[model samples]
Target: MIPAAAWGYQISSYPGTGGIWLRRAAVPHTGVVMPDDTDPANGPTSGSASSEAQRRTELGAFLRLRRERTTPEDAGISRGTRRRTPGLRREEVAQLSGVGVAWYTWLEQGRRINPSVQVLDAIARTLRLDRTERDHLYRLADIPGVPLDVSATQPQPPEHQTILDALIPLPATIVTARYDVLAFNDAYAALDPGLALLPAADRNVLWHLFTAEEHLQPLVEWEREVSFMVAQLRAESGRRLGDPHWTGFIRQFSETNGRFAEIWARHEVASSVTRRKSFWTVDGDEISVIATGFAMASTPDTKMWIYTPDDARSQRLLGLLVGRYQELGPAELLRRGARTGGAGRSSAH
Candidate 1:
């Protein structure tokens, strides 16, 4: 289903023929017919037939434009000197997408055939469509649902970084809908110093929880935490069905982590909410905390998570850790933590 935010409500209903949805408000008839109304040279007949014909014409034009803009290399095809066209040929697209050349040609011509979502997905992949382009393709092909906003992946502004830094003793980090760890404060780094050192590709919270045993060792209820995180990812996936990055991430992560694959296959989904958590410190002492997540006002697709101590003992322990980290700094703390062979190696987002 399309998210209410991504699509305008002006569309009335699907034509059920893989054609564009009909608008709720009709265009005025404006009965003044042009002199060329019946002239085959001008185009198809006018009125409702003309509207449907025009939509097909526009669909064909849209497909052509996207096709022309795409390059052979972009679709993983080797460039050849014989090719006169700017982009992929219809047969080349059909071959790459695993469809019949004639059918693909008809689709580009806006024929009456209705394409299944699976077929449209194949075509979208072949064209190297991004999230927005894929959504536009779906709409042109009369597929339902809204695309996830891509702006979520844009670099966060400096103010966001400042906000994270200001969180201070409390561990705080900003994450995208895909759970990419975009930014983190010193307190958060203190919580898991090794995380800040990890390569950007390995910074995803779920990826760490599932694949990195060292990071998982500190969590009190490992299975429960992992299951909840998987459910949250599943929920996000529903809203971004055909997105290449989202789909590719899932495929790669699943291939690396069998446990995540099993849980993901269950198709469970859950909304985000505050939860109490416990992590073991280097001294083997439990640090109970509450983790709260909130959507950012400036970027709805981004979220901020803050961890606060849940009890007096936990609070003192957190304060002590933060104070020591401030005094020693990240490098010294990491060096000491490494030599001690303690929970300092454990990391989180």
Candidate 2:
């Protein structure tokens, strides 16, 4: 007899009016041994099989939790007064994710079924999973080659922010593996005043370069810089294949930017290296600087990029710009500098 606690069910008897009593109990087969030819070392042990089963159960529960928290209105479905569920129903999830109701039901029931990455992506999007939650979903689905750290968008440390601030005269920024601007010094912000004023979501270097015309206009050799940046991103993509944030950014960027899509299709790849970049300032002055990157100690995946003026003239211009920023503040300086054509520069090596 199976233990009631182990099976999670109880046996009970019902008494009949005719003086007969009936007892019923359901016992599920909980064990299945592997074939004799199975390799002992490589094959799943009974313990391993049980663990996998538990993981499936947990995965189902997690899906249910996320689904229950997602309201119909959040999924763009019209809410009805007679709705009974707290959030989205199973059918609603299936419909929104473009999957069949029965298949999704089996998945939610913890039945063993292989889910493709594409299907999982659709489900994740429908659930509106954040980076961490998306990573958890991929792992629970048994996807291979998962990123070592999926929570790549976590806030930058305070010390890192302070370090950025310390690099006041020289333009500096701390960026994630995906080139998201985690922190930037005032000098860096002054270099591109428009970028500094953008929303946090649009602050990423790659996103700004590809999507914003103003970002590209200041670069001396726009095509060359864009190509190299794309190549660098392509190289990083190999290590970040299954990362939701990385993948989502690439997809959205490609869809929105025709040039990015064209460049990405070439499949070019390059490693990051110190280089000289030049920028044409609003004042029609050409400033050259050397740009270099250093890995942050607190976050290995993040790097600090500093742009130092290469020539005496460029250095003096940068110092002048910094002084103006200190005196007038970021917004006021940007306004006055633009009006006066006072500052604009680039890095060269």
Candidate 3:
């Protein structure tokens, strides 16, 4: 329901009839739209505020334009010649982007549409947009193109890398607050073979735990572990509503993991980080380990992860993973908490 106050109502509902007659009204589009000047009370009048509305209006137009620019051949549809339109048909775009034809129509008609980054990205991909074009599309839609906390979304800073190396024999790794595996010692890679095979972006621990069903499930203590992971991702996601990367990740996972989708939909957020977590290895060895996450002094996204064993058996397990460790230089230590690395590393795991 539109806000009653926006419609100049002292109290909601009609005084006598109790019918929601003048709750807030939306005037039809008129000539010329500007930004931030329209009477928001009148419900989207044709003035400057309409400019924002126009920008939204252009989202539909731009989507349609993008649709019209591509050919049937570009989208792998058959062309019998004697064509009229310059681009693919509305149906073609709907089919290609995995959206409903009616829904796409409503979108192109500019009906208060706010698409998730993943949906917009799918449309962008269907239109064969490059990075710059994709970025521009996001700007026009008034949504973030990438994660807002880019610093928090990245791998380790240089100083953190040194810390990871120093924790070498202990099988230490560096990850972002969101569970991105930024860097790891040789020992960590040896202990977790899957870590070595993943692309840098897929090194995100949360992505693996959430999306890679086969890889993590066997090792996970489902009742508590899964719940904890879900809670952690839930909290991180809340902190990044406008972040493009997080938006895309959530959409993808929501489709793939129904349980995760359900939990995320509840709007639960948990920042609880305990000092310890226990796990059983594939070899039937139960390891009691300490899990610590330190906030980056400079870069909020990056942190050093050190796994210290609580017992001799776990310490022996660490020895089997890597050799002796060494401390990093002073310069490497200085870059520890700052956002380092580049853009290519920011994609969803």
Candidate 4:
């Protein structure tokens, strides 16, 4: 049986084997093998042969798309003659990807071949695949994908809360390594209702920036913020490439968000968690929020997000939203950030 936590799965018994294999024939990305030793002969059953076929078909589409997007110029091949297609030919791709023409053809044809990690990595690099795409490539091959360490940090010791409180009127929050909003005083919530309404699955800032339209569309500078978030997560993923949770999250989100899917295909890996970001206060106000990362005393994946308005204008606007320092306008009651933590970012495996 596949783990319940796994998504997009159904059970089917193999011909002779007592157990089942998670054969994904439709959407290759989610098709994972939940192999059972008892039944090996039933032609690799997972839900039904259709699911496996669907998966294979999707894999073919992904490979073809990758191939079509890359050009001779991208592969450093001379475009001496007029080309019949927009991108590099299959032969050029095979050459640039460092795989034999026949092998690449078989892969594009959806033939059964277990691609190695090294080869897949090379192909991803050659195709200029971003972190998400690289993760997808691995998934299509049915390789055990990277995991994410989504463990919540231990509760902040009283001293830590005191530190957060000492920050005073300044908005501050303690977050887990996965960006879980662990703890924040009223000050933090006093600034942004959206922050308080941060979705349970969006504790990770990157995931929220990429997947949550409500959280992101409101941002005055959506593209810049989302790009930076992607770069930062890409950097983090690099450090923990073998983590399954992170990999799965990347995959699920890519499948859902077209914008994220496009950007992730670029294969740009970077980290800028400490960069500055500007936010618009709810009361038609604007302010700059600079991020600073602080390590936890004892907990892993725990850090703090501090928001200091650039000036009094932003401060007043924030107060109006949270109803804490009612100066700009009447105070309004807003839900505080979730007291209990929620799930961390998804893996892209």
Off by over 4 Å in 4: 1-159, 198-202, 211-218, 319-322, 325-349
Q: List the pairs of residues colliding in candidate 2.
A: 276-349, 277-347, 279-346, 281-344, 289-347, 289-348
lDDT of 3: 0.59
TM-score of each: 0.58, 0.58, 0.48, 0.47
lDDT score of residue 82 within candidate 4: 70
Q: In model 3, what lDDT does residue 323 have?
A: 36
The list of candidate 3 runs beyond 4 A from truth reads: 1-158, 211-220, 323-349
> Superposing every Cα of model 3 onto the true structure, what RMSD results?
14.7
Ranking by TM-score: 1, 2, 3, 4
Q: Which regions in candidate 2 have their CA more than 4 angstroms from the true location? A: 1-38, 41-154, 213-216, 341-349
Q: Which segments of candidate 1 are over 4 A away from where they belong?
A: 1-154, 213-217, 329-331, 338-349
Worst 10 residues of 1 by lDDT: 26-35
- Residue pairs of candidate 1 with colliding backbone atoms: none
lDDT tens string, model 1, 117-148?
66777788888887667767767765433444
Q: 1-349 in candidate 3: lDDT tens per residue? A: 8664565322233123344343222222211112233455686665665777788777888877878887788888887777676888766776788765544555666655566666676788789876566767877877633433343335444786777777757667766656767678765654454545567756766555555434222233444566677777777766557676677767887888777777777775577564565543323344667877666665544566666777888778556434321232222321221133211212122
